[model samples]
Target: MYIFRLAFIEAQLTDAFIQFKNHYGFEVQVCNPRKGNEKGSVENKVGYIRYNFFTTSPVMNSYEDFTETLRVQLEKDRQRLHYEKEVLIEDLWNEEKKYLLELPVEDYPVFKEIEAKVNKYNEAKLDNTLIHIPKASNYPFIYFIVTWDKYKAVSPDGEILFEDFRPYMNKKRAIPWISIFKDWIRKPRAVSYSRYKKYLPGRINEYLLVEDLVVRKERLIEIVNLLVTHDIKRINEDFYDLITGNNENPFGLDWNEYDALAPTGGEQS
Candidate 1:
């Protein structure tokens, strides 16, 4: 049995911590109370890291990037001569690394899985990130595999339903405006109060910012349909061409020619 002892008077292994230990196949050695000698190396390393890495607060774009930079710095540090041995740390590491266990073929997923139900808008919320699920009914449940940067929503049978790479965090809504716009255009009053209104492209937003409520609603519907027809990336470019009566298609081919080239009945026409 692996024993984990904390300095707390009522120390006990948490279920989550035990599960983590089991998954990693590591045995913890616990020392008796007030026996500080057992963890001397650990204490020394913690102080060493605090002095070397955490003395100054770092401003970083992401935790993963910061970790990678720290790893590189540690590797560079290994080139220095050892204080007591008078030998390069890298030379010692080269010999030590040979005794280490080989890496596993598959990486262990370092994430927590949680059950989530699709909202009225067919979206699932996990780790404060809104994931868009297609063809999911309101209140339909899914399992969300969440990590720091990304997440995947899977069906009960393990089929992936939705996956997002750049997950929005910090109370930000990952709005699927195209779908929402379909409903909002009919009820323009709702659009004004919607949290997602701020995310709308400037051109479309300006077009819908009409003084007359009825006129704004009608224009919003037209704009939404146009956006749905083409990719969101080309929205501004296509919208400009459409309004300006430009004959050139953004794809470099006319609509009729593109449609003719499109596959039909599971095969190219």
Candidate 2:
């Protein structure tokens, strides 16, 4: 069942009523007149009824007697002139009943509580951040989960931030970049040997001479690309085997020969 709080404006209320009727087969039930849009006509009538019928009447002797007196006065005012309409309000309401729609089987949707867990990182990981919070923490530890592209973590005080949703389940896990790099280099591709020279310490580059320029420049890019993608743990092993004669290759030239070649004209500085 869906529930909506009505707006105060007459046009807005009318439009909302129409939408509610069309979408959920429900009619507006005016229970608390003060809470709903009390039109000028209704307001004036209320004032008139209170002034003429209740204020002028004699004070009651007891609280119960006063309640009964007010009820009688209320009925008497309903029979009196109803301000703008110039007719009894009860009669007008009876005629207006035909325009009201039937109520729906279910109530309108209302606001409800949402549960979200906080992670050890003090962030809400939700489902995408490669972290998981414990099921037990799903209740007490949960404050709220916010919806972005997916659910994100929120603080107990309703503050939303990325850091609050840290992964609670896998606290000590580390991603191995070196192992990732080694796997990437095994694929077939053109190689360049010079790409890593710039990345090497400044001391290492200073020691490299003109004789080592060609081998360092050629096919180094392909090798670097391989190293970057493969797992870091296996990078040195892969680099050594590729450069030394230990591994057979179609390109029979050794690393020294490769480095001695002149730089390709279009190669980057």
Candidate 3:
């Protein structure tokens, strides 16, 4: 059995590291925080592995594929006789295997807890998803427990309120217009302070920054309806067309249609 040092992680352990240690049954010998002598083994071994096995990087399809490559390489390397003892390395491992502790009964669940704050709308935003917390207007702060696969929002008293699977990798994720529309319709001023609006085109962002609430709300409604299909990139082109006063309307609705409708209702025609 190998004597494991907790210093491999850090001198002062974090909560996550403590859980990792308990799960793996690692020996807890912590060294001086930045001492070179104590960190020598960890640093040298990593460099040795990188130079010896990874001189030519291997192309891997997935994590499983990479793991299988490592396992096969290790088994094959063990077939050779030991450099010092001159006995088969595999035989040495076989004799030493009995002293190793058994694996843990249950696999360690990988997750982290983060402190989150609720917006005025009683919603907690994580990435692009907004989780609604009903009757939580007064409760501004909460805990977000997240794993690679899922996340759950917990109240101060440790109640799991909202839980959902997280997107693995949304490289080009777009905030849907529907989610934006319902929220922004109430508060036009909030648009200038929005984090998501930064992603919109400079022209659209500039257009939305107006003192007229009526005009702002109307333009936002039109923009949201234009983006109803959620083709943000294409809709952005449409927005540029409107700003540039082009004849081609990508949304297929005349900008003056609202004025016409208002005039018709004036005469009750």
Q: How many residue pairs clash (N, CA or C atoms closer than 3 angstroms) in each of the candidate models, in the order given?
A: 0, 50, 0
What do the candidate models score in CA lDDT, each in turn?
0.64, 0.43, 0.66
lDDT tens digits, residues 1-269, model 2? 99999877543366546765777765464545555455666887788667876676666564557779878777765786767779887898778988887667776443223465554322233445533322323334554343321233344555543333123233333332222223223321211242333333222222233244344344343345544655322433344454343557534544443332232221111
Candidate 3 wrongly placed segments (more than 4 Å): 1-23, 32-34, 56-65, 118-141, 147-150, 161-269
Q: How does model 1 fare in lDDT?
A: 0.64
* TM-score, candidate number 1: 0.64
Q: Is candidate 2 or candidate 3 better by TM-score?
A: 3
**Predicted candidate 1, C-alpha RMSD:** 10.1
Name the TM-score of candidate 3.
0.45
The global Cα lDDT (0 to 1) of model 2 is 0.43
- In the range 1-269, model 3's lDDT, one tens digit per residue, is 99977644446678888998889897888777567899897998788678877989887865567789988987887898887899998999999998999989887888888887888766786766665554344577988788875677788888877666554423233344455555677888778786556665544565566678887898788777766653555654455464335556533544442221111110000
For candidate 1, write residues 1-269 as lDDT tens digits: 99988656645788877876776667777787789988998999889888998889976766677889999989998999988899999999999989776655665566778898876656677657565575444336888787766677788788886666535433333445566776666577766766555555555555555667887776666667766666443564455565335544332433332222211111010
Worst 10 residues of 2 by lDDT: 260-269
Candidate closer to the true structure by lDDT (higher is better), 2 or 3: 3
In candidate 1, list every pair of residues with a backbone clash.
none
